[model samples]
Target: MTRSVYVTGIGRSDGRQVVELGVMELLTRQVDRVGVFRPLVHDEPDELYDLLRSRYRLTQPASSVFGMGYEEAAALQAEQGTDELISRLVDRYHQVSDAYEAVLVLGTDFADTGLPAELALNARLANEFGAAVLPVVAARDQAPEAVVAEVRNAHDAYASLGADLIAMVANRVADPEAAAAVRGLAERLPEPVFVLPEEPALAAPTVAQVKEATAAKILLGDHAGLSRDVRNLVFGGAHLPVFLPALTEGCLVVTPGDRSDLLIGALAAHSAGSPAIAGVLLTLDERPDDQTLALAARLAPGTPVLVVPEGSMPTADALLSLEGKLTAATPRKAEIALGLFETHVDAAQLSAQLSVERSERVTPMMFEHELVERSRAARRHIVLPEGTEERVLRAAEVLLRRNICDLTLLGDPAVIRKRAAELSIGLDLPAGDETPADPLSGPGGATARIVDPQTSPLRERFAEVYAALRAHKGVTYELAHDVVSDVSYFGTLMVNEGLADGMVSGAVHSTAATVRPAFEIIRTRPDASIVSSVFFMCLADRVLVYGDCAVVPDPGAEQLADIAIQSATTAARFGVEPRVAMLSYSTGTSGSGADVDKVRRATELVRERRPDLLTEGPIQYDAAVEPSVAATKLPGSAVAGQATVLVFPDLNTGNNTYKAVQRSAGAIAVGPVLQGLRKPVNDLSRGALVQDIVNTVAITAVQAQDAFPHGSGG
Candidate 1:
């Protein structure tokens, strides 16, 4: 039978979706194909189901995800009895279960179901479906003893109905002590209970929600900005000096559109990072002039400026009724929800209950998931020299929100802040002592360390160090001082001086400009002869490492061998098994040329040095990756067809191959991750996207973890 878990809530507003999402994440991590089945859903579009489909990259058709709408189920139960209703639902459930290794069954909501005994109905369905039941109880606004009693009662109710109870959860507990007390009380029960405290951000209204409630026109802002949470509401009617102090981070400002003074003042405060406002709500149906709108756009480019048809009082009333939801559009909330669930829930116990096994094949989603989780496990500080770039700043926001790594952004601090404000991204700036605040504190608490190389106190120290390191190579204090002012040089120095664990640069800069500083300051590792780079080409089914793709132009035989070794080591360092393939225009002894000879020599050197490595060489591209071609050319070679690490003969072949595969094959190229460095410093392409920056930074952090296993310089 397919393994399954049924998530049911005891009452409404229990925040059970968190548990559902969390369980789905665990299921996907363990199995390649996990299906979702909602026994009963509303007639409208299901936000949670859409979120699951998009986030998990589920291939199942939407029509198959749910058994039936609530109205249809209600009518069937009223006319044909509950057993007939359940029998049809069970058939629908089996449709999903038959296709997937595991299935997640979302129980019907208790609100307006018109059922006389909803909880009993859920228990019966779970038992019929052969699914282990995990019940969620809303503990919000309840006393500690009451919360404990509710959990016990829910467990008893499910168990008495012959449902296989796996675990229980107490969600939305307002009082921390009460949450703790409930957790303690849960031990005496039949199963484990996970208690999650109230998170205001999850319940706060999103900008999009506000727009929907008030019928507001979106004057400015992109989808990203519209998804921001409105944690608080502020009415703006006073003068600039008086209203500025009232601003709070993630608050929506309510004022008339004619009050450009208040609007501009709020934007200025957001720019200064006093408190990052969520958006502006223009009341009374007033609209800003074109010139004013243009100014607002420049001041806060993506910040939502909304115009409503009602006055401030009515707008406030509408906002009060709005609540944030976990939807496809609000991915940030999903991250926050997942983080909360992972932090509090006992994943080990849950996995054991579900009997989930680890997946053998690593998909692209799995690769990205592992990278983020591993980087978070061994935290490291990574510096970015292109801090003022919009994509970099946006990627920084994602990194900070995900709690992936500590970041030090090198540029003019003012410029970085201004750019972040314009982008409407909340950055956690360093405190007075140059240390990041606790990332989990709240908005603006996970800021990156912003450093201006020109004004920083470490400039003199870095200049002196640079001068000492290069004194014999025509360096002086004046030249070192001038060079240290450059963000790339300063960032590289930060890595060399143990201030940062690693550095990722080259966005909006050339590769030479980015890595030149690293070569000058950080240099290559003592055990390695040369520096090379690799791109983790994330194909549809697996991740392949491509090396010498961005650096080492026209490398000789020795350099080629070093590249192969570095690429293999990198492949193993990541989760990929090292099966090296040295590529040329020839396969086996089929061709003769300088290029083929170089590759043949490199393969020989690899065999001589690392006899334990699995390697094949002097191979064409077709023979390296295609199993049919490999069987025809070299049938018995272990690494011929299943090559995980491909080493190009030179830059021309390596770079072109990577790009062609990336564009034509729709692959996600995660690097140009530089290897063999004394410290980890990776370069990015100038056209890298936000996700590209995020992936490179994560790779850099993982490299740092490998470099300093004892948590050095984090």
Candidate 2:
């Protein structure tokens, strides 16, 4: 099932739209893009959906969002029965859910529409949309006891209708001690229940909203100040001395424009930044002189000064009824809404409930998240050679924060520490855990450690080991001693010596610089004939594996078959189903070339070795990926389309194709993951971004889990 949540209000004034925006914030944090669906809306534009599209940068069209207006839905239900209405709603809902990694479904609102049983309708729609129901109950203006009953009833009502209840929320609760009284409902509910006190800022209107409501003219305003939230409205009937105390942060001062003295005092306070006001609302069509108005504009360059023809009393009534709506113009409220959610709701619990059984398609985000989760489950120690690199330090902080794995960073300790402090990365050992001395270190168990390769006590031991490994190649003891102090060599020796389970480097060095030590010291597994690399190409919707893109130069038919098998194992291990495609310039027997024969022979070898693997060979790139292209090029081939593992004939074609797709199609190529090694030793691109480094580290840690299942000492 698609991961989706439907947030619906049980009745009017629930103010649950904030919950939807908050959930969108969470979903976008998890995935790159999130789809929003509104089943039934009014004929007018959906202010909330517009806000979602603008703020979240959603690309869902109106055809998916405004499926059917309330009147149209009501007419359909009356004419064709509710079943037909539900069927069409489900169709429109799937249009969005299928396109996005995660979906947020906005349920039907019980506004002025004449539709009956809106709660039941929302429940049915949520079930049909395969969404977990998160019903919001408004507790404002009701007694604590009544609010408790309402929350319990809402949960039971949704659960009774076979709706998957995600969580229960009581929004805008009214009791003075509602925070204390919310315990009753919280304890009774089986799932997590949240209670949010009415926030005045979220319930207040912005300067732009007030201007629209009162039809006020902008005397002094800019685009920015017009978006400020009016936390409170103050009418300037008091003297200047008493009125200043009534002002609060984000307050909008209302006064007769003729009161130049009060207006000047307010602008002076605003200029001093004592209590920053939202904006000023001038009433009664009164005027400050030209000089004073110009002074007001200069005092606060972007602060708004709106003038209306109505009296202060009427303006107060209009402003009091208007509440803040989530829009692109109001980002402060979005922050506040997200804060409320992050503070009150258990994000981990919610995410666990939102998780569904894995489907056939593996998204890039899902693959990355699974890597982090899987690595963290069985922690390992992975060594990073470039400790002083800025991207490595940043990714180290993230990996430690996520508890992904303990890290060993190799460099000069003093330089690494100075740079890390400059970058504000905290790597201090916890209490009772001794920070390492200058040369050697503690085990650095669940965090990170900095090792100075030149000064470390293990350098001589590593020198002896390297001299033994490379003695046949005419390397002497003194030369091996100098070579062992290099960071990449030291880090790889750490992996070989069972000090760390895996290694990741190459951020500030060449790939050969990082991998040469691994090839020399660690060597390949006994069963493997050659060491090759595969890149996990993260397309927008799916993740595909492209093999030998970095390691091999001109592999023969046997080496190409080994690369395909290694790539299929890597893909399947990382949650991608590997339908291997031995890619060539030709499609089956369509063209004849030396490269085509090599790929054809490789495909035969793969079938002979692993008959269980679904594979096709001598296929073009389009035929390997696109179903329509496959239908024309190779009609009956099983792996013609939907191939997750694509093995190229040689390195030049695979590397160039991967780069072209990465640049043109905006795919993330996460490796060059070195395979067939006795222990996992991966390399990074010198130009890798911080996220790329993080992803690569996660991949190395997961591989380390397979190498060192019982912890660091393999």
Candidate 3:
């Protein structure tokens, strides 16, 4: 509740020294000294305690923070059973709290400190000592969210024990989204959340990455900024045979005749403006062509272009020999491009499918029996707006027929029937045609009267509110009439009142037109700080998640974190634990700024808040999938080495990055998977196909499962 809070008890491992230091530095201002209580201390020298003593400036017994000064007693005591271990741990906390202001409880390397008991002891101690309680979640090679969840669970246990939760610290947040998600969760929590970003490991070669995938020499024009690992092979048109050796070794950019202006221009544009090219190869058949040489010099003043004797087919063949070296591994540029392609083609295919047209593209998550079972248990409900588009009608029918969702169609029964008939479909009417009840008439109409009846204390409250609503300028009788008459809005009301599950619209209206009413009437989820969108990408070989694809503009770290959690959870619903990678211009600590800082801060927050999620970031798209690149940039980061979900920094980055990946990577982008809604509702593009509708419906069904387990619509 306060701007800042104190933290105390924490267990530490050998490598956790930096973690301890970073945490203490961040929290030192919030409270005086943090009681460092741990289950065990192993192989730690007296100097470690000396450092801790100096940092907190403790004058009391060294055991106050070090728990017996790293002696054999500490090691032997740490191996004891949970109950005894916790009993001593709690006893130590009370003794320390007499001097310190707050207790920052630490968990073990894994959740192995008998978490439940430790939390329980902390709670009892907090009550006895009258000190605020903070839980520091530390993990080794675990997902950020998972760790956060464990911390939260422990915190919950402490809270149940009657201890006040001051804040939570997530140690070793490795990704941008993971951090953001933790931060976001923290922002929404009753207490503050802190995440500690992982430090970079070592710089690995971009050239090595390119060379391992493709047998092409790294050719630089006049500019030479590419990584050193990229091999350089001078190009000469006449010496085709010589270029052959270079071709089999690495990535090669063949320029026009060595003295040509075109080659220089291409090199300058590519090397200076984009993904660093490995090297440049220039063709040279004749010695002195003054004009061509001058042009080359002007275009690529600093690039090192390899010169080789020229002959078209032979030169091309020399380059062809390197084909065997080129693997299918995707580069960052290629990955980003492919994501775009997948999104466009997939969205188009889905759009057509929703309209009943045959489509080649299948949604990432097909409506299989297992998924359906989940849906049945979850009981997702979907709403069809009034006067249904031909596609919406068909989609609803298919969903009901397929048992994918509890379908609700808003509009007059007769009108809907009429429309259904026009579309060659049958339907069961909910009401007779001539009822003509004014849904907006408040307590005057039969429907209003039906709602106004003797509930309890809120009956008059509802009546008054309805009357006042009608008086409000925006709540025009016409608009109110439409809301009551429109089945989609009406169905949304059902969801709001616990009668239905989810609502979908936008086929016959704009996104704003459909969402405005929901935002105004239904409200956001209880813990949700903001609303955002995600795109589920199913590539030929893998599934990727991209977010803020349809919502949020300049999201701060907190907002990005929310988007990451929402996206990760959505991905999990589709059967992926969602190793989320927070994307940025630079990988690891290669860059800096508020944007980079925000991502770093968010990653820290998410690690502290969710801890259960695997995430790493400030990573390039390439680093998300390429284990080799990840090894270089993030080293031991679990997510950076192999990420499945990617949270972009902002809308531009998210949208453009997704589009680029889909388009160039040949991936299928399945959704603008909306999150934080009450039910499994989704939007349809104006030009959506029938398959798109079916797929969207399927996704909604899954969401329904997530929202309401056991098919409870309410």
Q: Best by TM-score, which number? A: 1
Better of 2 and 3 by TM-score: 2
Give stretches of model 3 more than 4 Å off. Answer: 1-370, 412-415, 426-479, 482-488, 663-666
User: Candidate 1: which stretches are off by over 4 Å?
Assistant: 222-224, 237-245, 256-275, 288-300, 397-402, 412-448
Q: Score every model by TM-score.
A: 0.92, 0.62, 0.43
For candidate 2, write residues 577-632 as lDDT tens digits: 98999999899888887878889999999999999999998899999999999999
Best-to-worst ranking by TM-score: 1, 2, 3
For all candidates, the clash counts are 2, 0, 116
Residue-wise C-alpha lDDT for candidate 3, range 1-714, written one tens digit per residue: 111122344454323333333333333323433455543444434433455455344455656654432244334445774455446655675676665543443333322432344445445545554545556666445665776675667567666778666556565566666677677776666766656554211111233343333343433332122322233333434344343333312234555553344454444543342222344554544332666556555654444444456554566665543311111221221211222222212223222222222212222323222344355444455555533466776555445434455555555454555444323232333333322122212110101101212222223333344335456555655445434544445545555555556666666677666665566556668878877788777664356778888778898998888888888888777766689888887788889988888888878777777899887868888888898988887788888767878898989888887778878985656667678765555666665655456567667767766676665564
In terms of lDDT, model 1 sits at 0.86
Q: Which candidate has the highest lDDT of all?
A: 1
RMSD per model, one decimal: 3.0, 10.5, 26.9
lDDT of 2: 0.82
Full-model lDDT for every candidate: 0.86, 0.82, 0.52
Model 3, residue 574: what's the lDDT? Answer: 73
